[model samples]
Target: MKDHETLGERLAEQGISRRAFLKFCTALASLMALPPERAAAMANALARSQRPSVIWLSFQECTGCTESLTRSYTPTLESLIFDMISLDYHHTLQAASGFAAEKSREDAMKNFYGKYLLVVDGSIPINGGGVYSTIAGRTNLDLLQETAKGAAAIIAVGTCSSFGGIPNARPNPTGAVAVSDIVRDKPIVNISGCPPIPAVITGVLAHYLTFGTLPDLDDLNRPRSYYGTTIHDRCYRRPFYDQGKFAKTFDDEGARNGWCLFELGCKGPTTHNACATTKWNGGTSFPIESGHGCLGCSEPHFWDAGGFYTPLSAPVVNIEAATLGAAIAGAGVAVAMSSLDRNKIRRAQQAHEKLTVKEL
Candidate 1:
């Protein structure tokens, strides 16, 4: 691949028409919550921009984040957009290994020093001089410090990299720490999901390519467009929750009726992510839609947030007074509805018995 070629040129070579590229840019603009008018601007910027070098560093992780990105529907615009980036070094994706792989990373750092983007997945262990994980005999801590020094920006790609994930959960034997916990100087964007939404990962990259800066982030350093609201607020079952209908058991009538799963230990009320909206597996359905309550995988310390089946009323933190009041009111309404439903059933049974006696 020619290093000097613009993204537009590269896309043209791949037979991707200009119209398709523009459409892709428009989608990206909408994804980022930018105004419709900015789509053209984004298109122009990306067309002219050079493919920036990206060095991906993996540490103590399951490679699920990598799977999410690569398995994002093939031939889709998002996949194409990812392809446009000059991914210089990725442990899993690159063919080179041993000293050759390390050399590739070093070369990219040297070539694009102070210009490259560093993407990280997985937590760095600090216990025992970072002996928990290493690459080519160098500790993850050493590699991260060395690689991060010259990058223009960093993107922490999953819950592991952003918030230490399961490794940093309670009884964290590895003494795992997030990238932000270690690299304080760089402008880091946290895409915090168990394995984050793939489109979200690409969206962040597109934003940088278009606007030449990181997207505005929330207090947790997460892109506000993706992590601005709690899943419960946007869930389809939200109305059921407000109306006080809840599923007590997975096979109960309430479950069959598609009632809210709040009583079934859904962490959606406290979890801030786009899972309810953006969804997963080509927008098919989320955990709640599949009958399983949210595990709140995006939020920090979720692994240690108590049992996945534990009711939110028991161990959930930061329950506002208004929310508590709403829950109480909803429960009251549910009790009244239940009583009315029972009365109607009894009346129907009584009338049927009367008719049976008359026939006899």
Candidate 2:
């Protein structure tokens, strides 16, 4: 593959039409929350831009992130966008091994220095001189530092690489730490999820390619477009929550009726992610839609956030008092609105009577 060829040229060689490419760009723009008018701009930028060099590093992870990305539907636009990038090095996906693989990585680093993108998917173990994980006789710590030195930016692709994940959970024996905990010099974007949504990964990349800058990030360094709202706020069962109808157990009548799962230990109220919208497996359903409560996998230290089946209000000592306070507040708002509506109706009736007398 010629490095000089633009992405559009490569897609053309693959028999993809210009119209298809533009459509893909439009979908990406919508996914990234970009304006409809920006689709043409995105298409132009992507068409003219050179394929960026990406070095994907995996550490203490289960490869679930990779699985999620590769299995993102079949021949989907997001997957195509991912393929457009020049992925120079990835341990699991690359065919080369041993010294040959290491050489490939070194060559890419030297050739694309200051232009490559470093994508990391797991936590780096800091214990015992970082002996827990190694590649080509070098620890993940050494490789990340060495690789990030010349890259334009770093994308922490999973909860592990973003927040230390399960490896860094309570009683963490490996002393795992996220990439941000170590590499403070480069711009880092966290796509935090147990295994982040595939479209989200592609959307962030598309944004960077189009705008030549990283997307706006939240306090946790995650993209705000996707993680801006909590799962509870967007959940289909929200009306049930407001009506105070909850499923006490998984097999109860309320559960069958699709009521709120808060009492059943759903972390949706506190978890921020795009699962409820983008969903998984070709937009079929998320965990919550599949009759399971959210585990808050996208949040940092979720594994240590108490039981997955425990409600947020369970651990709080003032559960009754807090519930009462919330109910009273809601009631007060409802009453105020009702009073305003009544006053408007009474004034309208009085105006009609005055108009009748004036007419007479």
In order, candidate lDDTs are 0.81, 0.80
lDDT of 1 at 262: 84
Candidate 1 lDDT, tens digit per residue, 66-152?
988875642254444355578878999888999899998999999999999999999999999999999999999999999999999
For all candidates, the clash counts are 0, 0
In candidate 1, list every pair of residues with a backbone clash.
none
**Model 2, residue pairs in steric clash:** none
**Model 2's TM-score against the true structure:** 0.85
Over 4 Å off, model 2: 74-83, 314-360
Residues 213-262 of candidate 2 have per-residue lDDT tens digits of 89998767889889866677578888798788999999999999999898
